[model samples]
Target: MISMIMVLNQKGDIMISRQYRDDVGRAAADSFRLQVVAAKETGTEAPVKRIENCSFLYTRHLNMYFVALTRSNVNPALVFEYLFQLIRILKAYLGEDFDENAMRNNMTLIYELMDETMDFGYPQNCAVDVLRLYINLGNVRPQDEPEPSQLTSQITGAIDWRREGIRHKKNEVYIDVLESVNLLLSSNGNVLRNEVTGQVQMNTKLTGMPECKFGLNDKLVIDKEKEDRKPGVEIDDCTFHRCVRLGKFDADRTITFIPPDGEFELMRYRVTDNINLPFRIIPAVQEEQGMTKVSINLKVIANFSDQLYATHVVLKVPVPKNTAKAKIKHSFGRAKYEPEQQAIVWRVKRFAGKAECHINAEVDLMPTVRPKPWSRPPINVEFQVPMFTASGVHVRFLRVYDKSGYHTNRWVRYITKAGNYQIRI
Candidate 1:
């Protein structure tokens, strides 16, 4: 009889024979039975029978195979490193017989493993190492050398192009790979190569387009000319189009006329619905100056066309100034003038058994003195006088005024000596 022993070690459990006994022995008999069944079913080689058994060598070989297969299921990083190192070792020892498939697989595996690991947290050194490995595996040719299209090179270029878009700092690398791809595709006469190149060139040209505009819009052109146009009236000259006045008393109303050129005119006058009146003009004689005084003569009509209260009429006249005293004689009364103040005050009385109206006014003269002199020290004097009306009415004229009364009042007189009085007894 023979014995079979089962052993459990660090690698795994195995069954062993203690001796190679006769075919009739139980251990040998069981082995032969399993071989007979396998040969009968599949018609293949039967199990081998060892004449001498070595447990240590068998156990060693079994553990080595088991460990190799187990490591295949481990993390790819370790697998990649192992395979990479194996390629290097094989290249060093086995020389040209080094497995190209194994090297390529390991290089690709390293790249995939690095990408996966860095998905959660980037590892710069690992990524660089993977790139270096790929470059080495692709066997990058020198600039002068013409090499055949390699699978590894094509895959590496694609990987680097994608990485360039992600990491813009590697833009040169992306461009280089793209150029290589173009060169390859162009060599193969690919249609897509021409299309992509044309598009890139077109985009580059568009980016360099001119930034400035040349012509103006219509509104802007019109506004530019309009800005330079001048206003209708000159600034320094006096201008008048029409005149109108409203007041309570007819005698209180006075118009002072300072002739612009030596004379002026009241060209047109109209009276509307406010009064049933006809407009007229009157001239009075000045005894001292021998000048004719101009005034308005207005008379009330018994029946008029429009309403009696509201009136609107146009009076066209040249521009007038207040300098010389004048009077407005009305049917109702008369008003007095203050020459220095450029104003009028009306006076009323009964004349020819009816109420008559009159006005006295002072007019302003055009400024003869330059505006700068008024700020200096000045001497002032005041006086008064009384004059009688034609109806024996007592009236007073006061001249408590300045010599430089207005800009138009020139230096006509100056006091030379101070008057003093002395009495001797």
Candidate 2:
């Protein structure tokens, strides 16, 4: 819960303020401005700060700080979630690049939205779609405005995410399973960190209140089967959308929900076991003739199936900051020395699986006045492979039931990309 919400500029000047309770006074604003922003204290870098009895929880968007003040002991996670949701709602109303000028132009509209989204220090309905039904920037006559009773009902309704009487001529659904692979390899080829995070995104355009039951090849689900149990992905943890019925999922491991219209992420999961890395990078750097020149050799091998391929593969290998010039050659793809980046940047448009590529670079270093040792930063790699999942996660089945009994079309896709993928030299 919050006592007041304030939008302050980068200089700690209050741009907007809304008070829900009188327990927290205007002095709280000055406390944050002086103690947190003006002082720029390095004792604590946390988003939540405590000054006196009031707790200040805040997040920065663009050039403004959206701060929430509270006197009661509030759930930090919930407060942060509400802050982010507020940002999403503002972005929906305003443009993606909304800044100080945009907020100054729409001050009244912003106040109205803040009033409706939160009431008496408690978060109310913050759904953008639901709020858009009643609130608008354009002027409307009394007769043209939606009924107040209906708006109240929608706000308090169980299915606040979806509006009633939603109809579409063609009913169809699309599911995309996207995964990000993160790895940290030691110089001696030891696997330091390897993990995969994935999310299931859905785009649904269906009529009526259709109930959908989704299934996945999860280890927990497969382990419950007394017979014909198959190997499944070992999921460390998962989080679902608000529309999902958590009770049903807890009882039977069934993902049941009346999905929201348009596009939304259905679920996100993390996996640390049995991750299939798509690429193996081997790098060697040797100084030649008393650090006058350095020779760098890098080999990249695709580890996936031969039928698959990665697109827009890139690698960045760092060089000494005192390097003057470099000559590079590669078996495949393009390589060039970037003086500004102090690294050799190599890129390949399309790389086939079961293939290997090599790059060799000879860098000449200018003697530094201080003669400090090179830090030798890690090599970073980036790529995207379609129809692949590092966690081996697969959709088992998706069933839909509706009163209209109309035929529906469904499609599923999978993709995996690199994230924080680094190899030490």
Candidate 3:
């Protein structure tokens, strides 16, 4: 349970503060500003900080901090989640920079939001659409509001993310699977650790309470069905949105959920097995008599869709602090030395599928009196492929149904991007 919610700016001024229960006093607020904000407490440590008898769980968004204070033992995860939701709601109303000005101008609406979202230290309906239906800049008159009974039922209903009687003539659902691959390679091009983080985002424009079921070519389901089949991609862990029925998913490995309106992240998952890497970086560095010789090569192979091309490929190669000059030769794109970063930045406008690219740079550095090993940092690469998933995760099916049984259109796309794709030398 929460006792107080406060928003503090960078200079420690309280932008918006609300107390849900008397268990927290105004003195605690002053103390938080002094002890936490004034002290410039770093967030690398635990998020939950205890000052006197109160526990504070806070997160920063934009130039402000959203803090929740509680005296009792409350769920830390729930507190953080609620704080994020509150930020989302504020951003929805205030556009960009939902900061002091936005909150100050809409103080009444903020108070209404705080009261409605949390009552007696428990989270209520915090959905943006639900809150916007009634709470706005001006007061919502009784005549302008929906039926109290129906609104109340929607708030406390099973599917709170969606609203009632939503309509879309197109009745279309588009699912996009995006995966990012993170890699750490040794100097000899041997993989140390590799991981793929993926997210499934959906843009739903269906009407009349459509029930949806999503299917993935998951290893667990495949193994249970066919024991002799070759093992496919395995998901290490996954987390779904609140709309998904966890109990139903646990009973049977079925992803059944009532999707939220508009755009939302349906699910996020991690994969570590059978990752089809799209880029391989190879590096060779040597120390000459009076200068350093650096030779680097990057190979971006399009592993899927030979005709499709990857766009916006960038590779960053770090250099020594006292680097004198660099000569770069590349087959495609632009490569130049970035003096501010002490690194060579290379960019490829478009890398074709089933194609390879290479870069070689020779650097002449001023000799130093004290010889030391160049603490070479890992090379970072970033690229995006339109129709490919690094883990080869495929959506087998997406079935949607409603009481009205209206015809619906569905579309699916896959994308793969680099996430800390690094190589060390």
| Tens digit per residue, CA lDDT, model 1, 106-137 | 54543443343222221222322223333443
Ranking by lDDT: 2, 3, 1
Query: Could you tell me the lDDT of residue 381 within candidate 3?
Result: 84
TM-score, per-candidate, Cα-based: 0.12, 0.93, 0.92
Off by over 4 Å in 1: 1-307, 310-330, 340-425
Question: Model 2 clash tally?
Answer: 0
Global lDDT of each model?
Answer: 0.23, 0.89, 0.83
Sort order, TM-score high to low = 2, 3, 1
Mind giving the per-residue lDDT tens digits that candidate 2 earns over 100-130?
Answer: 8888898998999999889998998888878
For model 2, the superposed segments whose C-alpha errors exceed 4 Å read 39-44, 140-148, 225-230
Show the lowest summed lDDT stretch of 10 residues, model 1.
172-181
